[model samples]
Target: MNLTRTWIALIALSAGSTALAASGLTGRAFALAVLALAWVKAELILRRYLHLARVPAIARGFSLGLAIFLMLAAGLALIPA
Candidate 1:
């Protein structure tokens, strides 16, 4: 992917995620949505920017790590106060 396009996508994704959050979404819905969007952004960065696609193992490792972290965060946020 072109570096310029990748950067543009990253910026767009970031803006969209922020807009989603600013829309006043609350609770688990918001956390899940944001986490999902963040995952997309991370994948984009890892694959396009970091060229992790060349190393499938590393890519999967990074993605799995991110997924686990996000799931934990969501779980904690969704738990009763």
Candidate 2:
């Protein structure tokens, strides 16, 4: 609920993801899923920690940026180029 707990949860999620990647399950689909989760985490931070919802425009912009970055990075990583 609070920022600290949210951060801790995010860290835990990331660590778990890293462990999964290390376990030889690394695939583009899984990585894309992780990126989606990253976007969710970012939105949570903006809403819960930054109180972005208090300012609708800022909230939208911040979340949009987060989504864009996640999608782009994850998509690129998923590519075999």
Candidate 3:
């Protein structure tokens, strides 16, 4: 719950998410994997660093929007020529 632990959680989340994305996963599978990782990270931040049990709905909405954009962009890039 300390700052040090929060930083470590963030790093671990980044590594785990990136590894999953690089492991030949695709489509909704990949998106869900990344979203799951993000949730893990968010939980840590909200509980430890933010100490904010009640995050604003706008923050969650923005996070969801970003995730959707990333998934859409990746899907488009993977389209056949």
Give the best candidate by lDDT.
Answer: 1
The list of candidate 3 runs beyond 4 A from truth reads 53-81
TM-score of each: 0.84, 0.69, 0.59
lDDT-better candidate, 2 vs 3: 2
Off by over 4 Å in 2: 1-23
The Cα local distance difference test for each model comes to: 0.88, 0.79, 0.72
**Positional deviation of residue 20's Cα in model 1 after best superposition, in angstroms:** 1.3
Q: Candidate 2: lDDT of 52?
A: 82
C-alpha RMSD of candidate 2 = 2.5
Of 2 and 3, the candidate ahead on TM-score is 2
Compared with the true structure, what per-residue lDDT tens digits does model 2 show for residues 1-81? 877888898888788778767777667877876777677777877898888878999898887788788878987987895
Return the top candidate by TM-score: 1
Higher-scoring candidate on lDDT, 1 or 2: 1
Backbone Cα, N, C clashes tallied per candidate: 0, 0, 0
Say which prediction, candidate 1 or candidate 3, comes out ahead on TM-score. 1
> CA RMSD for every model?
1.4, 2.5, 4.8
